[model samples]
Target: MERRKFLKDVLKAGVGVTAGLTVGSALSFASQGKIELPLPYVKLDPKKVADRAYDGYYEHECAYGVFNAVIGELQRKVGGPYLGIPTLMFWYGGGGAAGWGTLCGTLNAAGAIFNLTCKQKDFKAMIDTLYEWYQTTPLPTYIPCKGNWCKQPFPKGVSHSPLCHVSVQRWCKNASVYFGRPILYNSKERSERCARLSATVAAKVVEMLNDYHFGNFKPHKVKGSQKTKMDCRLCHEVTMKELS
Candidate 1:
């Protein structure tokens, strides 16, 4: 009995020591400020990223969901600097910045991902590409499987703008779903729609990141002119980059 107790204690001590060393190493790396400004990129599978974001939304809503989908994957794939990032901080970005309905939380998270991975000179272009694609594309295009939270097919719509207010309102209008108050927003369909949308956005971000890393990144070109609010042309339409 004495010898067995001694062995158990030794095993516990060994585990504690190993855990301490791992944590200590992480702390030391943070203190040294060695995490590079543009964090290293490794190609990621977009499908996997989408699945992660879909699940993440069930836990933390849009911004944190999309952010974790990418960063968490990085932490898993490349352990050094990524493990130090406090991903939970992004939880505040949900509901278009705490339900104020400003920039879409997914876009906010995607912008951050681009900033962290792309070069300084390329950042603006990458953002432009994403915004344009988002504005024009029919979102929530990723349909969840039969057993998933959203089993039925949901309506899709284009925001024509990046604001969450516009995006969600436009989508709700298309779906004929009312979602402003807490009760309305809490509906299963609404939650599922956002979850799938989060997945779609995360997948797009991963695709862009992979293309950028592979040196095949291209700014999406506007094929034809599209109309925005007539009065806001000076601010929105007259820009050199065309929107379609």
Candidate 2:
């Protein structure tokens, strides 16, 4: 009788755990900026991660460049919940979130995946650095590396905004691709550029994750031309409201 009762209790505990995870995942999807609680994460190789981003971009033509790149590694290294997960849902992240042109799809994937493993305290700084990097750096640096699918040396441009339009416009300006001039910004080069950028972002996220794992993650202040006037107390106020 005691053995049967113990088995029943174990089954109940398993159900409870599954229910908790379901609730957490639902909340995660609903709350965009909120952090998801940390999950067990393996320290992925930064170089390999970047390569996957590059390859995946070319493979799927969207943030799948970032998603498929890392998902395979996650599946191979840490394969429990990630097993058999389909990329179909993530397809909408392309062309600025299903062609609406909002946030860069690469960054979107990076943020979504990053939050899954990063602790709450570390999420903001990592994302801030990534956005700053995207805005200020002349990108697609990985394209020049050997074995990259895109071989042309396109003009480099700095996008002051992380929005897709600004990034594409800057590329267009640099390449001199005007309104009836072959739309170089929308050509194959543009896809390659985004793929490379996705790789860069993926590698950096891996670096950050490793640092966090080792208790060495540090955030530097990012100061660019544009600054938003956000109140520091708002985060605490929001948390209080949520708790209430």
Q: Compute each candidate's TM-score over C-alphas.
A: 0.74, 0.68
Among the numbered candidates, top lDDT falls to 1
The residue ranges of model 2 lying beyond 4 angstroms of the native Cα positions read 1-36, 144-151, 177-183, 220-244
lDDT of 2: 0.68
Worst 10-residue stretch by lDDT in candidate 2?
A: 227-236
User: For residues 1-244, could you state the per-residue lDDT of candidate 1 as single tens digits?
Assistant: 4744564565557556655778888678768977666887788999999999998888999999999999999877764457778777788888899988887899899988888888887776787788888888988888766445455556788888778877877777776743333334556766777888899999999999898888677754333344432123423546545432
The alpha-carbon lDDT assigned to residue 151 of candidate 2 equals 61
lDDT of 2 by residue, 36-148 (tens): 36655776888998987777777665577777766667766665455545754566787778777677788787776666667777766677777777778887666536664
Model 2, position 210, has a per-residue lDDT of 81
